[model samples]
Every structure is written in C-alpha cells, then in structure tokens.
Target: MRKNIQILQDIVSRKGSSKVLTFSIPHVFKALQLLDKEGFVSRATFAKEIHLGEGAVKTLILHLKKAGIAESTKSGTFLTEKGKKLTNQIKNTITKECKVKKSSIIQGKYNHAILLKKYSKMIKTGIEQRDYAILYGSSGCTTMIYKNEKLVFPGNERECFPRDAKTKKYIIENLCPHEEDVIIISSSDDPFVAEISAKNAALWTIAIG
Candidate 1:
C-alpha cells in the first residue's frame, strides 16, 4: 500500500518497462472520480482528500494526463469520460483483490491493540485525527464476511484457523463499529503482506472518505 505520491512516481518511471501500470494510478483516479461524483473538486480540496502535498498531487495529475484518462483545468482536474470508463474497468478488474464498504457515520473508536507497531503509523495518524478508519488484517486466503453476526469464509476447517475466527470476532465485538465507518479488509497467503494490504486499505478508506 504505497502512498499516492509513490504510486504516481512508479507509474511515471515504470512506463515502457511494463505494459500495465500500478493499481495505485487507477486507485487515485477512482478516488477522484468518486469525489467528482457530485462535481469537480478544487486542486487543493482534491489534494487534501487524497493526502498528498501539492507537488506530489500535481505529479499524479500529470500521470493521469499520460494515460489520457484525466483532464485538468483552471477549475481542477477531472476524469474525462474516458477516465470514468477506465475507472470502472479497473474497479471490476484490478480492484477486485480487495473489497471496501462504507456505512453511514457511526460511533465508537478503533481498538489500538490490534495494530502492530511496524504498520501503526498510518492508522495512528488517522485515529489521532479522529478520521474514520477500519483496520482489517488476516492471514490465509479465506474471505470473512460478517452478516447478521455470522462469520463466513470460503474453505474447509483446516484451511482456516480458529485464531483467524477469533480475530474477526474480536474486531467486530470490540469495535462495535457502525455501518457508516469504513471497513477495509485485505487478504493474502502471506500474513505480513496481508497486514500491509489492510493498512493500505485503511489509507484508501480515508482517501475515498
């Protein structure tokens, strides 16, 4: 889960080396596209929303130009019809790796204990600001869905662990999170990477919010 700036930089440098761009480029446009759902957002406003400095933000705009997906103007940068169409394609294709759901703004605080020190920086900054954030971390490829207090995942018992179940239960029970709060979950066969994805998801949640 690299930040928008890093991702944008990668997109620019990685050009000609790879036919495909990093998912972050589309992810950024997706955020802008969502922000623009109602209309265009000022450069300053968009920068704040995406958590990037002015220079870094401008760099992103430039990358979008190269892709021919975004258009910039005095009013601000916006997704062209081309940008919007590409965003949808990316969401259905590239972004399928993780799913995010946002509920109406609700009450309660995040459980800091679940956060690991190495990965705590972004979440810490988010919570400190009292911004909405949900940290979802899990090991294994099993997907956990909570509906009506039931936890469901794909796999045989051996494929999933009781600890994983416990972790999910603890998150749901302790957080008492509202549907409005952003819930970000990421899974990988590697627990460490999954943790990274979850943190990235947390950042992504804030970006979209």
Candidate 2:
C-alpha cells in the first residue's frame, strides 16, 4: 500500500468538492477531515474531486454523520472540531513513523546500445507522433557515445567502472550536458544518480517502479 502521507498529499492537491475525501474512502477520512477543518474544501467539492456519483457521496456523508466527525448545514458539510483534531493527530503520527534515510550507491557498467536500438523504434514512433528526444544516462558513468554503430568517446574501452563520490561528481560534471534527460540503472543505489536528478530538474528518473 502507498504510505498515508503520499495519499494525504494527493487528497490535498486534488481540486473539486470536499467529496474528494470519498476518494480516500474507507481509508482516508482522517486526512480528509484536516482538509475540511482548514476550510480548504467542502463535502460536495470532495465528491467531485473523487469522481463519485452523488448517491455514493451521500452514503459516505451519512457514515461521517454517524461518526459525528461531520455535520451538514445550509452552506455544505463541515468537519466538526473533533474531526479536525483527529486529522492533525493522524498527520503527526504518520510523519513520525515514516522517515527513510538515503541508501548507499552501487556501481556496475552497462551497455545500453542494444537496448537503445530496440527501444529506438518505439521512441521513433513517439517522436514521429510528437516531437521528443531520447535521453539516456547511467549511474555507472560508462556510457560510450555512439554514432553510426561506432563508439565515439572512450574509443575501444567501453567497459564501465565503479565510481566513488569524487569520481561520480567528475563524470557528471564532464558528461551530462545541460537540459538533457537521463536514464539511470545501477548495481546499487547511487547517490550520484540522485545528485544529477536534483541538478537537472527537467530530467526524468525511471527506477524499477
């Protein structure tokens, strides 16, 4: 399951009625209550955000009513004070429980030429449909520039080598051009990949997920 914090962020960012809370449905009332208490949303707006029909939203409102976390008024459904407090408590509890430390970097050389060629056709199709560029990179820093099936840089020695923090920094500084996107795959989690990703905000990083 996705972490509650992520779910909460999604709910807060979505626009519409307070019914967006219904999207959290069975699982996200606590967060929804926070949005409500903040006056950031209304029950009907929440329903619209979640794409629920009026009947489904009404059912959820009934449940919230029985729990005493919500009340209906001429204006719209508003969260009760208890509901607001509970939402704050849930946010704090989840934040405290969900800290993750960064992991160490691992290195392994990879030759993406073959994979690039295979995906080239697909990429070309996309480019033909819509203008786009195929951007590639690696944590190993072993990418050899190729043109016409011939290696450009690094000549004959195309094998990738493990890079320490200093080496990774140097490779990125020298190799990654500005405004270029990169694809990173490594034997282990590489901080360099993260560093590059941060530096180039336009860059897109695709991990296994």
Q: Pick the candidate with the highest TM-score.
A: 1
Candidate with the greatest lDDT versus the true structure = 1
lDDT of 2 by residue, 57-95 (tens): 676666556565567777777667765665555433222
Please give, for residues 91-167, the per-residue lDDT of candidate 1 as tens digits.
33123222222111111122221221122222322332222212323331222333334433322212212445555
CA deviation > 4 Å runs, candidate 2 = 1-27, 30-34, 37-40, 96-209
Q: Model 1: clashing residue pairs?
A: 103-179, 103-180, 104-180
Q: Rate the local accuracy (lDDT) of all candidates.
A: 0.42, 0.35
**TM-score of decoy 2:** 0.33
